[model samples]
Target: MPDIVSFNKGHYYLLGLGVCVGVFGLIATLEHWFSIILSEATVKKLFRVAVLGLMLGLLLPHFSHFGFSRYFQSHGYISCDAASHRWLHSVILVYTKNEMLCKELIEARK
Candidate 1:
């Protein structure tokens, strides 16, 4: 049987907030430099670039999560067990639940 996953509103909210802030921060920093280079660009060009950036920003969290999981698994910070990958899944869940806990756990292993 497959494991059933549960959703926590707080976790999702935190993740969403984190993504939004991170994306906006990146956009702001990039815009400062891009503005200098594209000072003569049209509004339409800026709009297109913003759209593309938003799309990529939405995927950044997932990509970062995948990278963290891979690193943890390879470093033995998480276990491979029961042919289930249960430990790693649980760790990821805890991560979404409380990011501080995840950071502490990872750093504690050092």
Candidate 2:
């Protein structure tokens, strides 16, 4: 059977940090473009959102399996397993519930 894989915690944290930075940069760029100065309250709200995004990034791996499983199901494939690796990188793998179907999918890719 095929399996679904998740990344290590470090990878997720880095991704979250990147996302947080991107969000802040985007907002800053928009504000500059529109000649708008964010109030203290608005800046505080943005900071809150960034922190929340970081927290979500830390939790992303836990919920990622469900999303991948649903995507496979939508494509008429049943996910058989979800695995997390302790290696120093992130990876995504999709597997079908049936061995035959898994083999067929693998062969089709070749």
Candidate 3:
């Protein structure tokens, strides 16, 4: 059987907060190393070029399909009951719950 999953509102918030912290750390590290390695002008030019290229890549055919999931969800991909509560019970919340579960499991061994 498929693994059963449930979510609480606070859990989803924690997951997004975790991901935001991770990405913020990543960007901070990139900026720090970049300043150490290059002049201000070079870093500015490179960052502009690179981030622009990445943005354009998101518009390509292969990458375009990523938006379909959102579209389908909005268009009622499943029954109303499931669709209505999908946002409340997202993968983000499930991941956060799993993390808490793992921590509890580890502490229980003591």
lDDT for model 3: 0.41
Question: Candidate 2 clashing pairs?
Answer: 2-95
CA-RMSD of model 3:
11.9
- For each candidate in turn, the TM-score is 0.36, 0.50, 0.26
**Per-residue error (Å), model 1, residue 17:** 9.4
Q: Give the lowest summed-lDDT range of ten residues in model 3.
A: 89-98
Cα lDDT tens digits, model 2, 12-67, are: 55677777897798678868988788888988888888887787777775576557
Off by over 4 Å in 2: 1-22, 66-90
Cα lDDT of model 1 by residue, 1-110, tens digit: 11222222233334545555665555566668666433435535655565555554455446665675665555444322222222322322322224444455456545
Q: Write the per-residue lDDT of candidate 3 for residues 52-82, one digit (tens) a residue.
A: 5444443332333334344444543321222
Whose TM-score is greatest here? 2
Q: Supply candidate 2's per-residue lDDT for 68.
A: 60
- Go through the candidates in order and give each one's C-alpha lDDT: 0.44, 0.62, 0.41
Q: In model 1, what are the clashing residue pairs, if there are any?
A: none
- RMSD values for the candidates in order, in angstroms, are 12.0, 6.4, 11.9
- What's the true lDDT of residue 75 in model 3? 47
